[model samples]
Target: MQINKRHQVSPYLVFFIIYNSQVGVGILGFQRTIAAKAGYDAWIGVIIAGSFVQVFIWMMYKLLAKADGDIVDVHSKMLGNLLGSVPSFVIMIYYWLASVSVILSFIEIIQVWMFPTLPSWILCSLILGLVYYCVSGGFRVVVGVSFLSFIIPQLLFIVLYLYPLKSAHFSNLLPILNHSYKELFDAVKSSMYTIAGTETLLMFYPFIREVKSSKKFAHLGVLFTTILYTISAIISFTFYSESQLKETIWPELSLTKVIRLSY
Candidate 1:
């Protein structure tokens, strides 16, 4: 297959894709997972995890920029034809699993929250079709959709955060560093998976318009996403106890429920 060398995406679009892809699925459950280790100090765990992810993103970008090709080509070159295939296959499987999991989770969320009567398969099919349409348009369309997804959903967050403020108990975040350092490290490592999508940079570097500034964009994107994740984690920790967080499957959404819009 001949590779098409098309116009590259803007840095903002790159940021959108990285942020949206990472934020999906994981955001709903991130607080509970971190609370398991750091208790009410989960926000610190999120910050530590975000920093680790930024480092990984930097390393992946450096490797890709040095390779002079997309991830598959670079892997084959670095690891040789046979050994390289192993990592490539593993990555392919990971992407496939992640895609399916995201789709299923979206359906499950919609079924529970919005369309209680709808069958799971019906919701899944509708979502899968939309994903297929976006994916079929190739990388540019997917990036465009990602940009839209990141912006629109974010507006609701402002309302969600505001409602919880009056009732929030700042004392919930006290007694910081109460957990052992090892436990905090483990929480950071686990939450690092939430920011894992930046690894897509390995494939995207070849498509980035300003390849010279790709590193800057990648780091900037990670920094922006880390801030968002940290804020959400902090809010969830302050609003819910460690046990309450564990009991709530979707802490952010649970927080949103407290906000009643009279208009």
Candidate 2:
């Protein structure tokens, strides 16, 4: 089914969409998990996991091009409607669970930091309502939100890095290849969950205005987030030692506490 031109977004917007999807609440604390086994060398695992995502993006484009529609269409083409809908339903459930996980994470952060007495269900309901409103406006509204999300926090993060940099022990990252292959691979596996949102393309492929030209933008978005995660991991590694990082739950968020700005 062809999407209306009005509902379609520009190819370049794919960068922001992909970036926003991948960089969720996970980034705040992924450092601890990735570094658990691989030690400081886990930043390398981030790059490795990103390379896998790049390849996955390439294959998705090829398949979607052939199907000429979203994942549901691909399913219908390959399998009969009845049979295909089964797996499609499962995929939809998976996305729902993923979204819920992210939402719960956001609610947890809010409750822990800003509203200690706030009930989880209230925050969850409010967030779901807001999401429903935006989604009802169609994909374009979501794309606009994605773009702003990519731009605004970026500036704040740039400033946030300065505070942590002053205390970072660069020596923490020395002996880059000291970890064994097993440890490195363990890090890669853990990092995969943090960088796993690119599969969202399967649902929105048909919503892209220039589907063919959009591949580069999609991959560029992945590359950008990959670099972002890599840099984030490296910074967290250098800022906190092996034992300290293990104890600190949200390393990135904790980095913000040290930021000081005079009026």
Candidate 3:
């Protein structure tokens, strides 16, 4: 399905969409899970995981450039319709699962932190309603909303992470290379699973105003996300002790609890 030229977005806009999608859900608590195995070494795992994303982004661009089509079309050409669409089905299913995971995580956060009395079904319905409204507006609306999501969070990131630095023990990040290579690799794998939405580029590639520029923007998105995650992991690990980190479900959120602004 070709996206009409009229509905397409600037290649630069791809950066924000990629930012919004990858930064969702997982970053909140991923530090704890990755650190569970590697301890403070998890920050290194974040850089390694981002490197994997860079390689994948490069590979995706090369493949799309060569195939000159979206993933579905490429699959159809390579595998007959029956075989080709199997991969598309798998990709769509991955998307659906990731979406559900993100939504459920946010609902859990609300339940635990804000409104224990709020019905999950009601929250789910409201979210689905918002999804429907966005879908009804078409892809442009989706992109616009995602762009705003990326923009609006800049202040929050600063407030949440920077303000906590006063109490953060940068010393906690020491003894960093203490973990074995295998431990680091396992942590990287855990982080990668959370960052897996980059495949979304395959679908939006056809809608880019300039394909080459979009590819660059896509890599930038990954790089930016990598830095963000890496720094976040460091902050979380530093702000919490090894045992505290293991016990905390959302280290990133915990950072916000310590946030202070000097008068």
Candidate 4:
């Protein structure tokens, strides 16, 4: 499983990968979770949580850069062979769980919105096949597909953003900081899950061709992703009532339904 150093990705591709990976499967449910915690001011909570995640991204980069090893090697170096291997195993297990959960979530979305009669296993198999193709192509191809994914969804968002804007209620974002400090902290902690993929840098550093610029590109990727996530959250909260948002399965797609093309 030796990674070739010849296929270094540019900062922009790194940005695309971070944004695409972070945005998937979670954006649909994030509004409900944030609304539950911060009420009408959920966008504020999202912004704050995203900012904190940016910090975590930095910390992860620092840890990886300092260790100068892949994630498994870093852990083994830090915690000794036995203890480190235990935690590394747990992390890898969690990664597999997270990946499967994401794939299943996407299948569920397709079942509800696009293919009502399609079996979940069929959708899952299709997604797995695509994922296998990309993954087997190596990191460069995976990053390229990530860039394509990022572009298509963002273009869709641009179209969706232009609609009647009837659902937007700016007042829902007011009265910020009403929650207790502990409550706010808890909300932010939960929100961290949406911003978790930048930690991929740990596994990816060894594969990155430009090792010297890895931290720079990683930080840039995180910053760009955080901004996009915050903006998406703001748009979601602005357009939907707390109850409406909570009830909606995919708020962004729900928002898209309001768009009217001139045909």
Candidate 5:
């Protein structure tokens, strides 16, 4: 876990990696997925899930502090070489799965919205090439890309969502407590994947330049993600009826269809 000088990034960059890592393809369909269970109260589920994310951030920092390294080190020390290597290998596989999931989701979006005829292998190859380039340059380059990716799309997509509100039926969000506690719990679980990738922090925390001070920014990063998720849920609930939302696959993307441009 001896990070070289060139590989370390400022603590503030931690915000970008954590925030962007959690805000991927999961958000694209999360509204409908959560709404199906919690009805109009799903926004509350989003908030609850976000609260769990904040707790997770704290837990990870605590673990990293104790280990003075990443999760790999924790497992190695807590269990012993052979036993610990099992979980470490599993984590590596899990990371590969997560990467594939996000890439496929984006490729699906491209096929549906931009290039209906594009082949999946072509897209995968292109995306993996870019991934190889980013990974080869090392962590700092990846962090820079992540920061820009989160900020730029967030600005434009937030604007896209705003116009949908012009025709939104706020009454759609009424009877907010209609769901039972069990149903709300289901919704919260459903929204959890939107915050799933933050766990990767355990692998990257050792690279923060001011590792101790960076805890503050890491919490801020989680807070920022929670606020974004909460806002998106609120807008989506207000914009669509409960039944309508449940039937739609990607309501956030569908909302953009309502946007109009002036000449």
Candidate 6:
């Protein structure tokens, strides 16, 4: 539980970690699932889901700060090591399953668009191997990777949005509150799963250099991602009709097809 200062990363990096965790494979196609339930009003659901994540982040910081350790430590404190391991094991299994799901989703995307002949197992293995190497290096190394992961794709994503904007039907978002409350809630529920990775904070809280100051950065990261996702959802809604979005698996990825460069 006592992490050496050398192993701890700066509080500011927590923003990148939070951002990196929350925006993964889910963002690519979540617009469809949410819009399916609440129509264009689904962007509202994204904001609602993000508000919930902010509260969850606050709860995590409070709990972790009290225990002065990660979730495993908190569990052990509450239920002795013997009983605590059960829930901890379950949590680890959940993380394992989630990781596999994300990896497989990403692999499927690659195979569909880039490498139809690539075997899933081989790609999966290579990805896991890279993950193992980075993780084995230590938490600081992992944090460094998270920082790069947050930084590298930003410009490309911004450019991808330009093409979609030109063809967008802004009227698609008109009748925003037309959906019933139940439908909007369903959209919120789905958006919650898409933006769910903020829980990673539970595992890394102890590794942060200044826990108190990091709290604000963590919240700010959530705020930024929330806005990004909302904009993405709105863009997809405006660019594709509701029915077309339902048929498109990766609306965000499909947006890239519209981009053309002049020589």
- Report the candidate with higher lDDT, 1 versus 5: 5
lDDT of each: 0.80, 0.94, 0.86, 0.74, 0.87, 0.93
TM-score of 4: 0.90
lDDT tens per residue, model 2, 1-263: 69999999999999999999899999999999999979999999999999999999999999999999999999999997989998899999999999989998999899987999999999999999999999999999999999999999899889978789999899999988999999999999999999999999999999999898899999999999999999999999999999999999899999988888899
Winner on lDDT between 2 and 6 is 2
Q: State every prediction's TM-score relative to the real structure.
A: 0.93, 0.98, 0.96, 0.90, 0.97, 0.98
Residue pair clashes in candidate 2: none
lDDT for each residue of candidate 5 in 158-183, tens digit (9 for 90 to 100): 78778988987888878669879999
Which parts of model 6 are misplaced by more than 4 Å? none
lDDT of 4 by residue, 32-68 (tens): 7766776755556566776776777677767776777
**What is every candidate's alpha-carbon RMSD to the true fold?**
1.9, 0.8, 1.5, 2.2, 1.1, 0.9
- The reply for model 5, stretches above 4 Å from the true place, is none
Write the residue-wise lDDT of candidate 3 on 119-226 in tens digits: 999999988899999979977888999889988888789878887677789898887599999998999999998777888888877877878878788889999999
Colliding residue pairs in candidate 5? none
Task: Give residue 88's error in model 6 in angstroms.
Answer: 1.0
What TM-score would you give candidate 3 relative to the actual structure? 0.96
The worst-scoring run of ten residues by lDDT in candidate 5 lies at: 167-176
Instruction: Please count the clashing residue pairs in each candidate, in the order shown.
Output: 0, 0, 0, 0, 0, 0
* Candidate 6 lDDT tens digits, 84-196: 99999999999999999999998999999899999999889989999999999999999899899988878888998888899989999997699999999999999999999
* RMSD value for candidate 4: 2.2
Q: What TM-score does candidate 1 get on C-alpha atoms?
A: 0.93
What is the alpha-carbon RMSD of candidate 6 to the true structure? 0.9
